[model samples]
Target: MDNQKDKILVVDDETSIRRILETRLSMIGYEVVSASDGEEALNIFRKEYPSLIILDIMMPKLDGYGVCQELRKESDVPIIMLTALGDVSDRITGLELGADDYIIKPFSPKELEARIRSVLRRVDKISINSSIPSSGIINIGFLKVDTNKKQVYKNNERVRLTGMEFSLLELLVSKAGEAFSRASILQEVWGYTPERHVDTRVVDVHISRLRAKLEEDPGNPDLILTARGIGYLFQKIMTSN
Candidate 1:
């Protein structure tokens, strides 16, 4: 495709699913490439360097989880897994493997499009935030966040965060001590509507991921705090350095 929009790599063993997504996503302005198997998907991914990937869990040669693990070793590109398994454990496995999102099979085209736009929007928002001069720094003790560089450093050592994890951290730290409800967080962070009835556990999952990356003690985080009945909050607010 010869389009200016961010490219999407869609990986599925099912030809029909790939064709449907390719047609629908292209209709909404995303430049899309479809792969019939995981091996081909990885080949195209390396060559095309797509902005995002829509990977299916079951495929020939290699599975989506393996593909995700492989890709994460080299890049932090956004990933959204496609799965027929609706079990919570399967979804958790995908998230733990660094996927940004997941959609079950038989998903609505509109919902899928919304998810694609949402992921891209988060990436673009980070870019925009990074461009602002005075709003770039957040230093709390030994933890330093540079929104301009899209980086985090703890005790002077660089910390690696996936795209979704970084977005969640940025949202909380940008407004320190402010408690955000799970529903509000879902809407703001993941671009989910209340009407969509999205699982709020997605928010919980990301929070756990962020804690693992940024906290000195993931079990008892001092920075990102639980608000009990409300939601979650960034407890400290040191002046931007």
Candidate 2:
């Protein structure tokens, strides 16, 4: 939440672009770190461990996708890429490489600021998810998830979960502990706010990931059971083991 401590790494090849971005971000109270190329960007990233990254797709020495692939293998930090090409394919590729969001070249300063804030907020929530204590953990005899603390325990053992997956589990288990529609789940868990629908496949992926880690058998899920045409449910724990 501290703008000073929450650093932003702007990686771009063009000097003018970097200068403009740096000035804009700094004016708005953000601490800006700039890199000329992908290689330099990686160095700064490793040294600074910035909370959020604003990467440009085209760069010298190393391209955006290559750098992103390397970074994602190590950390799950939020990344919002800048695509000079402004092509839908480029955006899709960036997303495929674990980017949180993307903006075309010549984007608005206000829009950039908004995206950065959104990403940082989510990252902050994720950091707290594994630490804070929720009101309660949805225990379903076999599995348990503490929504407040964002911790998952299965068979009395703590289980690791990704951020989005944890959000999905919390949404399902905290509510009626019953099935809900996929569209609803996407809206609630993934923060899909726009009128245009999001990729429902994303939910399917997260659910599969949660079941694999929490359930003794991921194929046949008991904690997150599917109801035909309805959605999925997190059966409430009647008795704790």
Candidate 3:
């Protein structure tokens, strides 16, 4: 069981919810640290540097958004936001603030655990394969992608990207000019199956975030283009070094 220990930080104002998550996650081989609010969560985060964070959007003494913004300034640790609001804007806001994933409140424990597992798997997979390249250095005009380093540089300056963001970009660039539907992207990037009733907007949110980080003019992206009634496709590399 020593090998199964991955510390998880659970941040929520609700005691019952935190207790429930702590118990359930602990049972499944994770070491859980519970925080009642965003401030406390941030304190614990700096100290523990947990493997994953389960954050609540609505919390006293600094909301999840603020904590996320603060954390993004230094860390790219995976964050799964818990929100009571079902509005698409709220979900997008969380993603824009660097949350890896979001789940609506009143969700089942199993579903939350599944999301945690999916996110951790993606993070771990990226770290393990950082040295391997699916394709060599791809040059996209002013942007350069060093797949071997799992890095992207814009005008020679490194562009910061989260694990999932890089994964999404890599997937698109891997099959340049090939339109990948939202459902396909969700399956490939998020490990969500077609049988699962997952929101396709997740793909759109991630794509929008990628554009913001990687494109000089996110308003009119040139690298990743929308296929209009379909999905998105990356332009093929015109040069490679």
Candidate 4:
């Protein structure tokens, strides 16, 4: 029986928000560490190495986007951004910067907890699957996907991808040539059910991100293709002898 608690890093400028989250999350069996600004967040992240991060967008000295971008450069630890209400652009920016999820301000602790669990669950699933002995390497064009290692390489060079990005890619590559609807992708990749009605833009942004990293030409992607009316698919790469 593993009794180890998941550690979460909460980054916010507000003392109230940090305190509230720390208290509530601790009560729910998570080990919570917090920072009042982005730089502090990075420092704490380096030392604490939390399993997940709850990052606030607005902060003194480096903001959430900066921290997210910096973190993405070296770590794939899950990140959940806390954005201001009605800030669609902010949410999109956070997602583009490799945040796994976003929650608007004034959100209930219960809702945040649910989002945290969902994101962590996805990460855990990937970790467990990667640990399986049957997992093997997948070759698509110049790309190499190692399911056991949960890593991607392009033209023999490693491509840095966030955990969510890798999960999405793994799903598509696992069933190449299958068109997955955006809603279906949300359900399968993000672990959101149909009734959850999650914004499909999350799917689009992640697809775009993957293309930018894996495709020779993101403007005309050869690997990840749009299915016209349905959604998207990973093109089946044909090898010539």
Q: How many steric overlaps are in each model, in order?
A: 0, 3, 0, 0
Best by lDDT: 4
**lDDT for each residue of candidate 1 in 98-193, tens digit (9 for 90 to 100):** 889888888897888889888878866744544234868788887988887789999999988877778888888777878999899888878986
- Per-model TM-score, in order, reads 0.91, 0.68, 0.90, 0.90
Ten residues in sequence with the least summed lDDT for candidate 4? 126-135
Model 2 clash pairs are 132-149, 134-148, 134-149
Query: 2-36, model 4: which lDDT tens digit per residue?
Result: 21479999999999999999999888788999999
Per-residue alpha-carbon lDDT of candidate 3 for residues 104-130, written as tens digits (9 for 90 to 100): 889989989988888877766643333
Q: Residue 172 of model 2: what lDDT?
A: 68
lDDT of 2 by residue, 1-241 (tens): 3676778899989899899989988887788899988899889999998888899989999988888888877876777788877455666777666666677778887878877876566445643333223445455676766665767787889776545556667666655456887778766654554333344544555676677777878898767788788877876654332
Q: After superposition, how far is residue 137 of candidate 3 from its true place, in Å?
A: 2.9
Clashes of 1: 0
Q: Which ten residues in a row have the lowest lDDT in candidate 3?
A: 126-135
Instruction: Sum up the clashes in candidate 2.
Output: 3
**What TM-score does prediction 3 earn?**
0.90
lDDT (0 to 1) per candidate: 0.84, 0.72, 0.85, 0.85
Decide which is better by TM-score, 1 or 2: 1
Error of 2 at 12 (Å): 1.5
- Candidate 3, clashing residue pairs? none
Which pairs of residues collide in candidate 4?
none
Alpha carbon lDDT at 72, candidate 3: 93
